[model samples]
Target: MQIIIVGCGKVGSTLAEQLSREDNDVTVLDINGQRVEQLVNELDIMGYIGSGISFDTLMEAGVKKADLLIAVTGSDELNLMCCLIAKKAGDCLTIARVRNPEYSRETEFLKKELGLAMVINPELTAAGEAARVLRLPTAISVEVFAKGKVEVLKFRIKPDSPLCRMEIQEIGPKLKSDILVCVVERGGEIIIPNGTFVLQERDNVYVAGAQKKRRNFLSVSASAPDR
Candidate 1:
């Protein structure tokens, strides 16, 4: 995809590098000439030094022919303006990085009004991730799906865990819960365990199911005495 990223800061540069690695034609724009030069030197991508909201700068960055325009400028308003201009000037998808908490609440409204493809609030996303991890303290990571109705949790089995020697088939019945063990990482190997597959100590497990059921399972697991 031919993409134009407006902002050469950490987030912008990281996006450019990743997209470039995936063979996307990426062009980054920023007011800082040195940052642009640094990214251009480090990555196989183009860098332009200019304000993201400037029509001429965006045109010069080939926004007309681009497949996507990502506005990640420091200012939320500037990011929105960049996306608005991109929509009016080109038939491309626009994504804006909006960090302001106030603006984050109206993301859907802003997308509808400005025709943005996505509005990403990194701070809000990070907070949500942290909250999910905190809710399940034993989980290394937690991901929600199905409109937050389903959860996928990653956790490791301790050496003294009752689940250490349990077979996959026994988990649901023993815990009196319904959940799917999706993946198991043991001894640096990944396995999609079947019913007969046995869990071991230090095995990192990924489980997915309805959010309530998963929480129930976790609650029981946390209170289970080592046997």
Candidate 2:
């Protein structure tokens, strides 16, 4: 994948580094010569120091042949303009970051006029994830899949928990429920085990099952320690 990223701030540099690490051909653009030079020194990427909204600047950054174009400039207007121009120049998947709460709101006018594939509000997404974790502190993390029909639950076993000594066969049947533990992380190793695998203390367990049975499974297995 060839990716063109505009804006070389902390987030932009980090994104470029990660994409480059994944072996994607990445090009980054920023108006600051220092920023472009620093990113060039830090990561294996092609970089251009110019305004993202300029056609010549973006073309030099290889936007015309880009598979993905991400514009995350500080101003919402600049980001929008970058996306629009990138979209018009070529058939690239475009993503724009909009900070203003009002500009991000979807309306008939926006959906019709703006060729925006997606708009991201980083602050809102982070806040929502934080709120979910705060409420479900018992679970190390949570991810919903299968259109919300299934939930992937992660929680670590405590030293004193009796279930640590049990095997999957014993635990699944004994619970009098349908949830099954799918993955286990112990000593920094992850395992996809069968019924024969025995769980141990301090192992982070990931369970996947129907969402309807999730509460019952968590209530019997593990809990978050009070702060």
Best by TM-score: 1
Worst 10 residues of 2 by lDDT: 104-113
lDDT of 2 by residue, 156-224 (tens): 887766577888888767876687788998898989989989988888898877655766677777655
lDDT of each: 0.88, 0.81
Tell me which residue pairs clash in candidate 2.
Answer: none
Query: Candidate 1, residues 31-54: lDDT per residue as tens digits?
Result: 999999999999957989999889
Tell how far residue 49 is off in model 2, in angstroms.
2.8
Q: What lDDT, from 0 to 1, does candidate 2 have?
A: 0.81
Each model's backbone clash number: 0, 0
Number of clashes in model 1? 0
TM-score of 1: 0.90
Global fold similarity of model 2 (TM-score): 0.78
Model 1, residue 75: displacement in angstroms?
0.6
